[model samples]
Target: MFRHAFRRFPLRVFGLVALAFVMANILGGLIGTALAATIGLAVFLPLFLFKILMVLMFFRFLMSFVGGYGPRRPCSRGRIKDRLQEPPAEPTKEETEWREHVRLARKELDELFPDAEQFIE
Candidate 1:
């Protein structure tokens, strides 16, 4: 098991290196080659990504306060009331099973108390 994990470790490392290189190239392309070279790709890449995330989150927070009803809550768009008014075409299998279970429970309770009227009183 240890050997298997070790074997795949190099492949995972290689993938990470490739990803870093790609991100560095993207950073270099967007923000100029000189800046990328000065800051160094390894250190700057994660910081730059974190800054972007923070800026986006800050803007989202600001918008929530600025707006009227920040975002619309999801609601039932269909005629749910009408659907409820209309009876189900047929009792579902689960519903049938539930009814059967309830019946059995009631029967067991009746057996426990032979006189139902005395228990109610």
Candidate 2:
């Protein structure tokens, strides 16, 4: 769908949006070239680092959010202590059998090549 729009109405969709966004800053009437420089830097740096497509999509999502800022939330909600404090679960029967097989393989490997780094344990 977007590929089609990119082929079709680029100016109607993104081109004019970008143009208007830049021009709005240019014509904000007070900031002058400072705002223009900031806008130019934002565009050029993101294009250089992350490439044009990702930067454009980021700007599109930014424009979609109210006042161009999403709602704030904590970076992470969970307490690491909770998980660390929990006891590990017992291994299942299948896991036990798998471990036995691994142990046997390691034993064989040790017998065959004692100098090996021994990965199984």
- Give the TM-score of each candidate: 0.32, 0.31
The TM-score between candidate 2 and the true structure equals: 0.31
Q: What is candidate 1's lDDT per residue for 1-121, written digit by digit as tens?
A: 9999999999999999999999998987978877767779778889999999999888776666643323541223334556778877898899999999999999998898878858685
lDDT of 1: 0.80
RMSD of 2: 22.8
Residue pairs with clashing backbones, model 1: none
lDDT of 2 at 41: 95
- Best-fitting candidate, measured by lDDT? 1
Name model 1 segments beyond 4 Å from true. Answer: 1-78, 115-121
User: Taking the candidates one at a time, how many backbone clashes does each contain?
Assistant: 0, 0
- The positional error of residue 38 in candidate 2, measured at the CA in angstroms, is 46
- Among these predictions, the greatest TM-score belongs to 1
With candidate 2 superimposed using the best TM-score fit, by how many Å does residue 71's alpha carbon deviate from the native?
Answer: 12
Q: Each candidate's lDDT (Cα)?
A: 0.80, 0.74
Worst 10 residues of 2 by lDDT: 68-77
